[model samples]
Target: MKRFVILIFIISLLFTGCWDKREINQLAFVQGLGIERGKDDMIHLIVQILKPGLLAAGGGGAGGTGGGSAVGKPYAVFQASGVDFAKAFANLNDELPRSLFMQYNEIIFLEEKFARSGIYKTLDFMTRNPEFRRTAYILVVTGGSLQELFDLPNTKQLERYPYKEVLGMIENQKNTSSSYVCDLNEFLEMLEIPKEAPITGRLEIVKKDGKAIGVRMAGSAVFNNDKLVGFLEEQDTKAIMTLKNKLRRSTLTLDKGLKGEKVHISFVVIKAHTDIIPKVKGKDIFFDIKINIETHMNEQESKYDLTEPKNLEKLQLLINDKIKQGIEHALFVLQKKYNADVVGFINILHQKNPKLWKEVEKDWDKIYPEVKFNVTVKSIVRRTGLSSKPIQPR
Candidate 1:
């Protein structure tokens, strides 16, 4: 009985301390959206620091309809500039009462000029900061100022900030490869690899009624060692996603025999697997890529007889062709044009045949462009909803 009483007292003592406790009202909560720009060759930081009271009040009412009005009168938006990012952040301390915290920061936007100038310096601070999360997405503004991107108003169904809205869009879309979140850790990993290149998300603002409506992700910014080498269009990004097996649910529109007519097909990927085989034939090296994809048909624009085996074969061929084309295009762009292998093919090669990779590690970049690849894609369409037939009358 005495021992039990002592154990209860010990448990009670554990709950009595406030050693690291912080009051909610005392600390500032940052939503984790920031924009960096360059002016006069110096760095400028613009942070979208959230106002808790305003956010709470906005969500208090029914239908969550108070975001625009509340955000219009923001709790605080600040900009600071300095030679270094840390110095700039310190400068901000003078302007605000609370410390600049980045625990919840989700997105980082860089102006085109700033990105083109170079992002390595700015990225150093992000990676080194203990308060920052490695999962925060990094983006490049295609053709706008950092302020413009940050100032874009929230116009979403759920009354959230424009920054949060952009993050939500990327999270919600599966067809779009550019929407995949890229953080500092992934970016740094890509940089460390000599053969692999890194890609950052792109954002562009859309204005309506002279007010910022929203910002959309354009594509991806391909980088060759902290330098902006080029950009991958949306189509190219899709191809990259297909090769990397990162696609979730996407629609592919193809010309299905009817000369002028187009067929739209949506697929929900059930399972996807990829295998890379590296072959060394004396002086030549070849890569054999085999991908197995299983999907359920979500939509079909035109009528197709799935019951007939012959028609189903044709549909299978069409899917294979489309997937093949996408892979080929992605490889061409990554190897011939960009000269950067963002798909981690070298890692696969090393895994498959470590002995061969060790010998050719030094010349992998030169060899990568010369290496021939044979890609084979197999797609299985399992089901075509309840009513497989076309809804429109024949």
Candidate 2:
């Protein structure tokens, strides 16, 4: 009986042997992944591979933070091409000595041309792959391709970690621009709804003295389904953020006072909320948007006394008009010009009243452009900043 027990233990040990386990050191860890179309009209996949040896040597800058981003040119670049994204993404295996480890990949950039052509194919592999994280930042390169952007040098950067830089861009702007850092999962979820369009962060290389120095997060890239339609400018993007109920903090620069001597007052939005109310008028569709915003006067160029209740009330009215105008402008550009509904109004209808959505889901696109919107803003001045009134000239 004792011999039988010993034999059973030995058999269990034999079955427990690792058949598919991969060692971290033996794998070629990827830092960033870039996809674009090549001259051959095929998909090109670019990967920034991290060297474990150099990483083990110990380094400062972004490397110390312990992410997959490359420090300087210490990382290797691998380019592979094929007919489809799946084939191109897999072709890198033949070029690298170690197994391609995308589990560490931090960012993915797609050229504007390819993104406009339709990123459905590239997204398929990334989403379906169990190794890839859904949290990786995804951006559309508008100004230049990954090669050109990565080749640039940045002095402000602790090291040339493009992934870290892009991540930092969203991190630093957390207080100013609502959380606009979009990931692959969020984008995929948005694409599932035909009534909603997905927009990703826009990336552009900054050039000075005829040289690319660094990269900047350029607003956002709007997509009509899988194709790139247009972009939301700074103010337009802010308006959308407000409507999405994600505007954590932002300042509104309003031109008030006399026409001949107009003054710009920057109102810091302390709190904001938006409610979308859809109305079905016979066969026509209309929307009633209600916005409530609370702000504090941050900076002023006029002699307006923000401490005064009467003056504050007047200022609130001006802010109301401004907010309404901004929202209207964004709606015009998105609905009239692009015909893209990134606002998710249709989904709102479905959620609020599915029966109604079923009736107009087919013709929502046709009704979208023709649909009229009524925007109403109610604003309040919560507090006066350090000063009660504007700084008078000495």
Candidate 3:
């Protein structure tokens, strides 16, 4: 009987609930975080805290809207400043009654000014902190106030949080291929690579009468090490994504001369592939880039039937030219204009030809500009949409 009681007591200890469990009511859930430079060289931190009470009220199909946003704001934004991120966070925590919970944070916004100044310290702090979430998507805020971005009224009817709207925007990149998105982990990994620069989605403010009305994620912010070097516009961003093989799906439009008249042709790119081969001829180094694309004819404004083999072949050639031009433009900007290698050129050489990489690793910066690229593109229009040819005007 004594042994049985001791065994039972020891088993009960194993079933003890979480030792440091925190009640939901005692924690403030942070949905998003924004960092920027402040006056007197202080670190400015902005946090978006979820309002549980409002969320609860918005539930149960409120107002026949089926769980839409509440009448009032579902989140609140707060800002604090200090000499460093840790102190800034401590100051912010003092203003709230509940402890800040950041494990659920979905987004991290770095203001343009702060990114330009340098993001190494901020990134280091985040990586070192156990509470910070490394999976959070990182964005560079431009042409707006970080606070306003967090506090802006939700335009999406079903979204209860501003960050969710941003998430949807980021998700659209899979189809649009107009912007670049990078999470904390991916950005850090890029930074650690040699001769490879880091980039993040560009979040720009849209305003009405000098007040921020909304935000748009278009283009990308390029970086050299941890500092901002420049930006890639939407077209350039698309080209870069294509070269990097990150473009999942995209639409392209071209005006081609058909039957002695110019007509518009739209295509939906369903598949794309890019290959880069590094070669060394004596002391000179160069690369061969081949881009293969498969697209479907989406729209035709003319009466001509482009599905015919000859016409289709001509259309494919035009598409190949257009894609080639875009890729060349992107290469010119990345190599000649910025001199930043964000396209992973060094990685290819290192993986394929380590011996050559070792010899040029010391003076890659000087050698990269002179490195020529031989580009070839092959595009095919696989299928035409419902209407093979446009209706006659007759």
Candidate 4:
């Protein structure tokens, strides 16, 4: 037995081979990837690679400032065109001295046009490749091209890390309070299901002073199966987020119960639970959504005294109404206009009442639009923060 154990250990030691090993200088770490379908009917691939010099500079602190500033373009962008994804990736590698490593890639930006056409090929290539991680975040670029978004001087260049910058924007769960950060795995999983849709973050420029300043994560790109269908505005996505219990923090603007002024209040979500009560009467089916949210006030811009029980109760009712409005708007756009089930109602049915779902699976699209939604939102304001009223009015 001791000889057998020694033999197994020796075999395991031999399994570690130097054949696949690569040195640091021989491998290039890809931070971001952008894919777009060109007008010439080919795939345009763009990649952002990290440089060792900038990392060295960042690692050495203030003392390593010498000659590091001259190492221009902290990350380099390489573009290539090919007949298909595999060819495009190979062409990208042809342009680089070292192999383009993709395991560390954080973000993949797909053009709206490309995503709308279909993503089966791209997704297949990404998933089949051993080097690409399934967890990488995917964003759909809108209002502009992928190259234009990448060409900006400040983006993925100069001193900042673009991967971290954009990834940070999506990962900042509390600050966003509204954006959908959909990963490749989550998207793939959605594609495998029937009567369900996938949603991703929208990368676009925010206008300032009648001019475009910089790109920000805004809205959501809705997908029905593998093709892009439509986009949900910030307000609509917030409603979906609320239903999914993914609302981290939000600034709710209540236009009621304040007598005159609209109340602008920010709050951190303590807990949000949603229950989809599927109603079935004969062959007719609809959904009743129950959203229970607990939040404490962070900042309030209304003159209502949150300390008073009556006023606070009224404020909570108003908030509940606003939340309902948002949910209705989202349901209208998704179920009526787009007829996409990005809210996972189909999965809810499958989990809760699988027998009914099997019968209704074939005609979910037609059934979904006609389905009625009863959004019941109950919200409470637990804290009033430092001030009970707005600092504006005396």
After the best TM-score superposition of candidate 2, give how far the Cα of residue 122 lies from its true spot, in angstroms: 1.4
Clashes by residue pair, model 3: none
lDDT of 3 by residue, 284-392 (tens): 8889999999999888877777656787787788899889899888888888887788888988899999999998887888888788888999998888987677688
Give the CA lDDT, 0 to 100, for residue 369 in model 1.
89
Candidate 2, lDDT over the whole model: 0.80
Task: Give a tens-digit lDDT track for model 4, residues 1-394.
Answer: 9999999999999998797877877887888899999868899898887776665566422112223443555677789999888899999999889988888887899999999988899899988898998889999988776766665656433235556667767867455566787889988998888879988888885545644445778888999888999898898988888887777776666554456565566666677778888878777787889998887777665566666788887778877887888889899999877889998888888888989989888988888888888789898777667777657644
Residues 336-370, model 1: lDDT tens digits: 99888778777777888889888888898788888
Task: Estimate the overall C-alpha local distance difference test score of candidate 4.
Answer: 0.78
lDDT of each: 0.71, 0.80, 0.85, 0.78
Looking at candidate 4, what is the lDDT of residue 222? 94
Candidate 3, residue 69: lDDT: 49
TM-score to true structure, per model: 0.84, 0.91, 0.91, 0.88
TM-score of 1: 0.84
What's the residue-level lDDT of 300 in candidate 4?
61
What's each prediction's clash count?
A: 1, 0, 0, 0
Off by over 4 Å in 2: 1-10, 60-72, 154-156, 258-260
- Residues 1-394, model 2: lDDT tens digits: 9999999999999889688899866788788888898887899888877666567665422244444344546566789999988888678877778888877776888888888889897788888888888988888886667787666564656555667677777776556773355788888998999778888777877767866777777678899998888888777887888888878888888887523267888888979999998888787778889999999878877887767778777888889999999999989999989998888999988888789889888887787888789899999888778778777788
Task: Rank candidates, TM-score, best first.
Answer: 2, 3, 4, 1
Candidate 2 has a TM-score of 0.91
Instruction: Choose 3 or 4, whichever is better by lDDT.
Output: 3
| CA-only RMSD, every prediction | 5.6, 3.2, 3.4, 4.4
What 10-residue stretch in candidate 1 is worst by lDDT? 60-69
List candidate 4 segments past 4 Å from native.
1-16, 52-70, 155-159, 206-213, 260-268, 389-394
